[model samples]
Target: MNDFLIPQHVNSFHRANPVAKLLCMILLFMLTLFTHRLDFVFYQMACFLLLLLLFSGHRFWKISLIILPFLLVFIASSSTMILFGKGDTVWWKWGLIQISQESFYRGIHIGFKSVTFAMEGLLFVLTTPSVALFYALMQKAKLPPKYAYSFMASIRLLPMVWEELLIRRNALRIRGVRSLRGGMKWLGILKLYMVPLLAQGIRRAHRVAVAMETKAFDGQGERSYYYPSEYSKSDIWVILLLSAAVAAALLMSILLPPFGITDVRYR
Candidate 1:
């Protein structure tokens, strides 16, 4: 059941220009940051979730499971601030902490804004592949080839790092070594595990550097790309649609001032 909602690797959007997706996500992030009204934030989040259901092809519950904990933590911290801060209509009182209507509203606003930002971020993470993003950056964003290749190489090495760590752990296990389970000291765990992982990472980095030099990867000058990224009509549509959404949100905030136009500050 959960598998059905998982995103297909070979979707049309997956093949769409990564630059467009990146720019659209940036617009959404800007919207998340500037909007201050809780109602508007909630409305935006709801719309994003609905779109995710329709288009993400990823399990809604799985993403929610990853997102909710951070949201809850943010809410808790915001609630703490509201409880401690001064406000006009006090609901509860303690020696240093007091819950009041103004603080409560502000906290709610902050919490919802956080959710809006997280949802936008999740959309990017779920849709964009790392290689595609790096390729787009190099071709479209005019990022230096060497820097882009280095960044992509680092990302590609993550699986190798994990594999090496697992192999080390299994070997240790076979020799009756134990991890920092059941309240063992973390410092000891780090000494046992992290040092080897660091060594392996450094070794891999050295090999990658050597390979890049072998390929004559000078950061500057002309280079040919095997998978040269190009903009398409779909990319234009994506950009226009997202830009329009951002503009519409801004316009709505202006016309309906109460929705989100006002600058909210904790007072």
Candidate 2:
């Protein structure tokens, strides 16, 4: 199967611009934050998921499962709150907890609301690499270079932390300290995990400082990069395409009724 996420061949879209995607992603985050309408929110989530699926391989589905717990809780609680709470019109009530027509619709709305925001974040992280994103922000967006470097460095450190945790967890398992079920025991387990992780993090930081010093690392203003990024024709198209997509979603949102199109009548 051909990989879609990274793209085997740097197509016109991917090749010409990294900044376009960054801008689009930032726009996506802002869009999700701005809207409370479920339909518009769903449109954004749908677009995000559709894009991820197109670019990402079948493993994309697996990647999405990373947030299954959040989805499950969101759906479950939203449904419970929506169905069993009383408001404007009471469908049914159990003393303090009453199921109302308004509550039910609200619950469904809340579920989709959470899902939309989650997908926006997922899309950004899945598509953008840390270093590339940082480079774009620093050079293209003219952001602080130190901020970019720190962001990139944190991202780079993630894998090492994951590996260290995995190793420590495995060692604990081998020593019959596998299950973290008890009270203080859990804290002990956390300490066991943290000791090596913190030590390594500090060690890595010092090494990075030393390496930078050895290379005469001066965090100065206006640094130049080797692979200079320039906006191309495709970059222009990407920005245009993303703009059109967002506009369409917004247009649809305004055309639709304020509290949603149809009223629900639950029997």
Q: What are the root-mean-square deviations of the candidates from the true structure over C-alphas?
A: 4.0, 4.8
lDDT by residue (1-99, candidate 2, tens digit) is 114445333344455456777676677667666665666765655565665555433364565665577578578758876867546778887666778
TM-score of 2: 0.74
What's each prediction's TM-score? 0.79, 0.74
lDDT of 1 at 235: 74
Q: How accurate locally is residue 51 in candidate 2, as Cα lDDT from 0 to 100?
A: 54
- The per-residue C-alpha lDDT of model 1 at residue 35 equals 70
lDDT of 1 by residue, 1-267 (tens): 134434754344555688878887887888787776655665666656655554554665766676668668567757865776657889988787888876776777677677767767776666766777888888899888888888878877888888988998898899887665666587887777888999889998999889897887745766778788998876776566555555565555556545442434555
Query: What would the TM-score be for candidate 1 when compared with the true structure?
Result: 0.79
Candidate 1 regions with alpha-carbon error over 4 angstroms: 1-6, 9-15, 59-77, 171-185, 243-264
